[model samples]
Target: MPQANGHANGHANGHVNGHVDGNAAPLPADLIDPRQVKLHDALHRLRKLEAAKDIDIPQLIVVGNQNSGKSSVLEALVGFEFPVDNGACTRFPTHYSLRRGEASTTAFIKPGPGRNEVEKACLEELSRSIRNPTSFHDLMRAVNAGLGKKVGMERTGDTGKGFCDDVLMIERRGPDLPQLSLVDLPGLFTASSGHQTDEDQETVQEMAETYVRNKGSMVMVIASAQEDIHCSSGIGLIQKLVRKDASLNERTIYVITKPDMAQSFASLKSVVDQFRFPRPAHFLRNQDSGRDRPRSLASRDAEEEKFFGSGEWVGVPQAQKGIAALRTALKEMLWGHTKNQLRRLIPAVQDMTEEAQRGYKRLEEAGRPDRRKFLVDVAQDFDRLIGNAVIGNYVNREFFSSFDDTSLEVRYKRLRSTARALNKRFATAVQEHGKTVVIGRPRPSGRPHGSAPPPAFLAAEIDRLYSYPEPESKCWADYETWVAGMVDDWRTGEPRGQASSMAYWALFEYQSRGWKRMAENHLKAVWMVIDRFIDLALAEVCPDDGVAEALRRRVMDTHVDKLRLAASTTLESLLSCHGRGNSGFYDSLDDPHTSRSRAQALISKIAELPSLDGGGSPRNAPAL
Candidate 1:
């Protein structure tokens, strides 16, 4: 075979004649035909690589109507006959690889997946039977057996008794054969017979479409010159596929068979002129007698020469007619296409190999136990969630944004701010609404105008305050009891005690109720933060339904409950201290009108009073 020979031009180095440009250098006499040999070998390697990777390799697909000279064209190209019959002779796809060598043929059947050992053994025996076949009939019998067909089964659709999609591969090598590889799919048909159902017809069409529709394939649509071009044949089907992918017209080749029998060339000429079918259409006479009658190689050649020399085809381009012309056209087309595909194929195969390696490495790592790494990952995720909850740096917007107009994370971040605002409101409610008497204001005309003793006035004001329940108080009984004690203390106070004790208890009780409500609200806000944190963490760390549920049950549920309880306890304790009277009550007395400077000296003694909870003296109370 012609070698690359350090030349940049592929056709220039090849021994193939007429394929190269006319001005290219001539070839040596000893060189093998590169068009036939080099191209075939390159394509063979590509097919092998594609099969190994389970990728789609480029192909030349043959499609035609039943008994439309499809088998004749293929047999003529391959320089041999395998099997052909009247109606739908080929049920499954048959791939032919032709080359120049000794006259020999080998066959192999690639049964599709799920075949048992028995079926494999049967296929192997069938292959052996085809190798030493005495006649084409023997080949047909082996093909039927390999496809799992019974001897008497009718050739129906793919749903027939022994229908399969597995390819029947045959490699034929002989002298003067053009190097070519082609797949002959099942012929297209319109109506179904008693044996072939509508399902069968569809199956056959589907199998044909599978090959012709491949973008990487060069589709050869065969139509008998005697038949209507617009009929529901393989040509029409090819046209449909070409329409869907306009680029296919550049790769598609139309082959007109049985041209000698065509009654009128006017319709065919119009089709070619209008570009109805993709050209160049090669017209050939493959069969002179019936389909079953075999023609000798010399006789076939003589007939082709006679047809071309006749007056009917005088003006037709020599390159656009005859089987020999078609063979040359195919070789040239395959060479150019194969070169382009190979250029692209190398990088694609490399990328696929690298990707597969990465996937394998990942799978290998997954097979090993790495609990330490897993735990570290979980810890990292937990820390991230805590950070997000505290600082509102959430990643998934859907987790919060989709739940409501405002996200849960945003609300969680606002918890502290919301609590502070409520606390301020609580203080304002205490300052404006909690006071029963204005220190500098006089009594109204209809009310008791005369001032009683300071102790008696304080007791009457406490009664009025406790009679109407404060809107914020949760514990009314405790408040009433505390008020009664304050009144009693004021009544029993020493003479100078009036200023220090004046209405302080009523103000203290009112402020305590406001603080209690604020504390409860703050506790609820903290609970909401924890709840949203659990939701955010689960969504991030355990998005799977099962994993999230397990985490919620095993970890989040108990953990959040404990957090809620602890926060509730802290807030409740703070509120409870406010609810009971504090020693700081005397510190709130700032009135300078009374003669209680000496009583202020006694205020320090009352400031050290123990709390009602029996805990140590209360810490300095929060500012009202």
Candidate 2:
């Protein structure tokens, strides 16, 4: 079984590639593979550095049906004792970590609960169990004695409290690059046993789905005696575990425990063969070959003797052989590949960003107008009213003692009145300056002298000129750029309008080439700017009593209700236009770009509104 003359330098005990004491020489600098350059290279370098420091700990999770020796497996691996019983022993996720020299290892055990009240109770049970485990003999006695109590907590059944129903996370210190840690998932269907009432099957199913969805470690399923490992229940659970949305399949390992039962051990191979296990290899010899491999003092000899029959071992030789085979296979599988470890746990959000970029390009080609037109329009209006809008009679007066003393309510009311006045003045000016000019006459063919232009054809032309484009490439680019800019603002705390330029273009394209464009743009732009301004203003508003109290007092003393009514009405009208035919530039914000643009527009308007001081100044205005 030891492979005859297997020496320390032989493949069995040697360091990975056999470079003196396991350290290999560095690769040549010019060995750069272009495919491996840039981001991929950076990723590779990071993985290597992490691997060099030996921090890529494998998480081992133990899972099984009720009383399937799940806890025993953990105890045997760590050479310690975990509470065991005849029925469901562990109830929640428990983490175990240990240190050996400079290396470390971690393991996690995840379980389900029968009731909401039992969750916290079970978590405390797991914590206490790990901190104070019974002796090996006592644990063995408890297991053979049948379901006695909880594995980790002191309270039993209805009395347990404060248990968290989550997977256990364990970390053990060993070599810098320790073996993959283990995880023990709870029995698939037996989480609700000791409770007084029937459990919510839906709740358990949801919990199971949540665990599978968020699993950060390589998964392993436990196979035991009495339970048909190949039954629909088992296959269905395994199928659920393997299903994935990304480019790669979730890796799973199957372990057949309690092989001491001949019925299970005899047919385990046939059952395991059903599931496809990729990257198979073999190294260690089978124990049934009339010999036994010598294990280090780290292995539990007494326990192995008791578990395996007096004349025969308990675990399948194929299973044990499969483990070594699995290790070698994993090493070969992991060679040069940076994925599959825990670090990939953080999803690759960059992919979503790339998809958005492609969408944006298509939107640009759809013949939408740009946002600069809207900005220039607004700027022109400002140019016309600059003298009156900025240098109003009350502009020079002090409205508030300080930024903190100013009332947002008072500020909003004054700004609304001022904005209405300016808008009236601007409209009157435009009306007075209005002059229609005929550019050219139509190329008319023979027709009745008083016949009007064909109404149907005229309507068709109007529709063609004003209709918004269907959702497609035409809207995607602006959306992507908008979303990206919003993300940047979130990260940098910069004023949101920094990204409004893209949104402005998106809206302009929607409005100018369509009908009632100017009116729609105004409504949408004002709403967007108002939303953004409020967000910024609220951010500046101090949460403490001083500023909040001052503002509360001012609102009570002043007619601030009118200001709120105006802002609310303006916003409501803008929102109403969203997704309607007249919406044009102010279309539905379901798309990321639209949402971002809307946010920016709101911020811009809010910034333009008057400050909280009694003088009715702009909050963003330069100091006198």
Candidate 3:
């Protein structure tokens, strides 16, 4: 291995044949073989850092379905429960340390569009969409109204349709162990059962999958034994993970929850036998236990200690035969043959003396005239590399600009038109299929033959439609909610909460009558927007050429690695915006409005076409 010699300045001291000499001059590019030169330099640097050992503490990522006792199990193991309320406790992946006394840092990992990021983007969108230049309060009202309508909310609130509110990270340090770290991820399915709850469920599922796919850390999946654990949605998640890189199997652990829910000791045995998962563990907790009454760290530790025992001992028996048996099974799992059954790979350290000696002599005399020609050729490679980079960048930029100025607009318009056509097609499709979207209002035995409604029955039918039986006032209320939320843009801010009101009425109307058509149209519009956004994004993120390629070559070449480091530092931030997980202008919805802010705002508001619920004023209604 090569080492960093006294000639600290790699460039000034100039390496000869890949070795840096304070007194020696750099060999001409024509004299050295680039391959040997590169290898020699790399070897020298490897020698310098060879003495340092990098140890990364393995992080255990714990996640599962909502209320599947995910947080409970983590709190039980890590010796503390994070803050739990009626709402979710963990919104994003957070790191927790077992190292005590020292302050544990709380780190949150969230998906794209964080709060500040989303807020800025939304504000920008609102500013652009709303035509009127109003006070901050009025602007907020319009924004709130837009958002409320989009999400079908009764009134506008502080939040919008973005999921930034769902992500958070928390870290805690423990005194006893410094090496162990745990990551708590948000529950898979949400506990909330609302109209958009399914969407939330899908989002959470995607988030979990993305986390799992990117997880360099180990994983512990907690599940309830009582739930139909083998359903497609449940098993699909597991199957997808098992198919990831081979290392996953070794790092994964399955935990069955709610052992206390079992009927008897025999049944518990039967349950464990049925799952047949290797080294599976079970936890017993009351089904109705309030999340607020979390056990203290010490108490949970004691309980864990009792069940699995310490690293050394086995748990004792108790009068509750089932509990004792479960503990015994768990202990066996932790320390007995079951654990040892899992295959593990530990690499054997090699003895370097013999091989180093054999390679050293050849490596020493490797820099002859023939090698020099090779080295020159290698250096020459940098020129072509840089050339390609320049070309790639130029082409990418041109394409990006083209997309932005022309291609993107064309594609967006096409997609928009397609989507709208599809929506219209769906309506035609429904009618062609002879599907009458009936208004579920009280009707006589049948419609009398000569009594015809108006030609503009679309709006009137929606107004009279009632999916559920209710009084006239309630029907009107539902209508208002429908009308207001329809066409409402939820990305805007509402200073005075009027946005919420507008959304309430708009969404109700939008969701009613011709819903299939509406959905088809909306989805088409969203797809078009996303597609254009993605195309423009791809264009703007052109690869940097000269420096990037130069650095790549240097890193590939010899002992002094200044080029690679310099190049990396130079390009990291610049290219970061183009990476796979990068966000675009839509994500930056709150950015300040640039051009036509008022027009954008006005267009967005007019697009919403807010309606009144029950065709009555909210100001006149008494509090429910």
TM-score of each: 0.48, 0.34, 0.38
Which residue runs does candidate 1 get wrong by more than 4 Å? 1-36, 49-53, 86-88, 113-136, 145-163, 271-275, 290-294, 352-624
lDDT by residue (tens digit), candidate 1, 1-624: 211111011111211121222322121111224744665566566666533445455668988877677876765665544365434357777887665666666677766454433344346556666664444545655687556542213353444443456677877655555566788887788888765668768878888887777766788888876666667387678677766888778777888876665666666667556655555778877654443134454456567778877876877888888766787777666666666666777777788779769766765776646545654676577666666545544454543343344533554433334334334443333433343332333322331222222122123322322223223333556666766676666563545535334445445665445455444543443343455555656666654454466667687777765765686688778767755546254333332223245476656555588878887666764221
Give the runs in model 3 whose Cα sits over 4 Å from its true position.
Answer: 1-58, 87-90, 97-101, 104-167, 190-192, 225-236, 243-247, 284-295, 301-405, 408-624
Q: Give the best candidate by lDDT.
A: 1
Once fitted onto the true fold, the runs of candidate 2 whose alpha carbons sit more than 4 angstroms away are: 1-62, 77-88, 97-163, 166-182, 190-205, 231-235, 241-250, 264-266, 274-624
Q: Can you write out model 3's per-residue Cα lDDT over 187-251, one digit (the tens) per residue?
A: 67645553235666777678667656543355667666455455424335766776766545555
Cα-based lDDT at residue 14, candidate 3? 14
With a 3 Å backbone cut-off (N, CA, C), the pairs that clash in candidate 1 are none
* Candidate rank order under lDDT: 1, 3, 2
State which candidate, 2 or 3, has the greater lDDT: 3
Question: Residue 45 lDDT in model 1?
Answer: 65
Cα deviation at 502, candidate 3, in Å, is 25
Q: What is the C-alpha RMSD of each candidate to the true structure, in Å?
A: 31.5, 27.9, 22.7
Question: Model 2 reaches what TM-score against the true structure?
Answer: 0.34
- Model with the higher TM-score, candidate 1 or 2: 1
Which wins on lDDT, candidate 1 or candidate 2? 1
Q: Alpha-carbon error at 117 in model 3, in Å? A: 6.5
In model 1, what is the error at residue 579, expressed in angstroms? 99
